[model samples]
Target: MDQTTLTRPEAETTTAAKPVILTGDRTTGPLHIGHYAGSLKNRLALQDTHTQFLLLADTQALTDNAHDIGKVRRNVLEVACDYLAVGIDPAKTTICLQSHLPALAELSMLYLNFVTVARLERNPTIKDEIRARGFGRDIPAGFLCYPAAQAADITAFKATVVPVGEDQAPLIEQCNEIARRVNAAAGREVLPEAQALIPEAGRLPGIDGRAKMSKSGGNAIPLSASEDEISRAVRAMFTDPEHLRVEQPGRVEGNVVFAYLDAFDAAKEDVAELKDHYRRGGLGDTVLKRRLEDILQALLAPIRARRAEVASDPAQVHRIISEGTQAAREVTEATKREVMDALGLFRL
Candidate 1:
């Protein structure tokens, strides 16, 4: 053996400050500014301190994108590219594909046994989704089982922490409920208790200032949007209708321009001044919108640069996801064995 062959404890610190956290986004379209501000950027910071698992949720996505299988398949790579572009270091965090995790699928099946339909029906998030989609009197079976699938995603890795927005708290609760039931039925606790890291950024609204941002809602400014596109989007952003006059006293408290400034601008004092000036009806919406454009451009430029670089070499991108899935596969498979034995689904 060569003298330089082994690197002993000279490698790296094994202890992480944060526990493993399971978090991800569904691939309906390109990740938007809202997603980046609300969660993606926080995830980047967590990679250094936490055992983070960033999943590209294609399976969960299929619940809605089922009709557009091509769209779902296409967005998988695009979403991975977006993640990488946004600084989700694959080296420090596991970037696995959700559909690749069979254990999660199995776990979902087992969890369904414990949850009553009434309970799933009563979930606030589910009810909101159903109403939003106008699924009155006709709900997809997969849509109903979404929370059960979510339990599998969280428990498969035995994740102790899950980063979720406030709206999704009920879903995480459902995951814990399934964990408790499955563990009690087995006469043992196998799943790690999971907690939520709700970032203070909260759920970002659309550029139109219409509640939550969504592709279907036609108001999202995607992470991969071109400079011209971003400019167009921001210029047209909904400002205080009362501030029709550039010299008119503008309200910044609920102004979409001010909200975006709060989320993206690092200079709080400057933003505060801008808000006050606008509130006094001295600052114009165009001026504020321009400042917002500058801030958003500053925020998205690097993401675009990185996305272009990774897009040029998609094979490397795919390889990273493949490696992550392989690593997650082993962990999930072992958990599935425990799950099957608990359910007496094992072979002699």
Candidate 2:
């Protein structure tokens, strides 16, 4: 596979046309600030200019949460609520349910043939996740094959752009490889290759200073968290332990508080000054935590209120999802037909 196909050319910009963007969250839990800094903020910005589809990926969630089906089922609404709460307008972005789109599943099954098991195992994202989850040889087949499933999701919509974290860029590469293989076999370009759009902030670390902030890790501050919850999470944030005394110099390089501030605090100059002060001594963790707490409280207040308002009517949320899923079904089914025709499948 040519590596050049993985990204759009510099000459082709979004200004040329409204590109299709496919992005979503697994129905694992409520979204957090990590999600916001990583992708949600980009989604909010892209919805107006691009044809964006926000998938409530309940099916993908099952790859890891299969043991607790209830958790995956319930968080579908929770994730959708978070999307709307964060200002993803249902009018601009098509917010669809993954399970409801049978075409995506069919496409996934078809795409698996175009990719090799060895290649799947070699995927950097998959390798890292398997290690993190300690799946060992007991790795679930579905979990191992998620890159193909993700490829199906991306190509089913003919998406040109996919917003993902820096760590997940390999998945996009795998997706394009599958697309190229399928197109090669069909003797034409059946699926459009996609480019991964990595956010500037990259991945946000957990409050405990772990590499990634995740709900299961109990280190993520959910967007819907109450003011008290936000305050407590900030207070417990991991910082330089050696800086026990206010007069001791602190290291900001690996401090989770500084990481969050970098991701959230709009005032870059002030944060830089604070970092310098901490490094030179005289800055305390308490003061830093207080600053982060204030920023988070202000940021989440409106999101929490909007989430409460939208969640108050379950039927309304369901209707919004159903409508978007119906729309997605039409789009994905058409692509499935195109792919089938490209492969000369019988049209009985």
The TM-score leader among the candidates is 2
- Specify the highest-lDDT model's number: 2
Q: What C-alpha lDDT, on a 0 to 100 scale, does residue 62 get in candidate 1?
A: 85
TM-score of each candidate structure, all chains considered together: 0.91, 0.94
Which 10-residue span in candidate 1 carries the lowest summed lDDT?
A: 2-11
Give lDDT per model, in order: 0.81, 0.88
**Candidate 1 per-residue C-alpha lDDT over 1-348 given as tens digits, one digit per residue, 9 for 90 to 100:** 121211112112123455777888887788888888777777877777887787888888888668898878888889888988887776677878999888889888889999999999999999998898898968888888999999999888788877766678899999999999988888888887788777786777788887777756789999888899999999889888777778878776557888888888889999888878777767888878888899888888888987888788777778778877877787789888988787667577
Q: Give the TM-score of candidate 1.
A: 0.91
Q: List ranges where model 1 is wrong by over 4 Å.
A: 1-18, 343-347
Residue 89 Cα positional deviation in candidate 2, in Å, after optimal superposition: 0.8
Candidate 1 clash pair list? 248-281, 249-281
Shift of residue 214 alpha carbon in model 2, Å:
1.0
For model 2, the run of ten residues with the poorest summed lDDT: 1-10
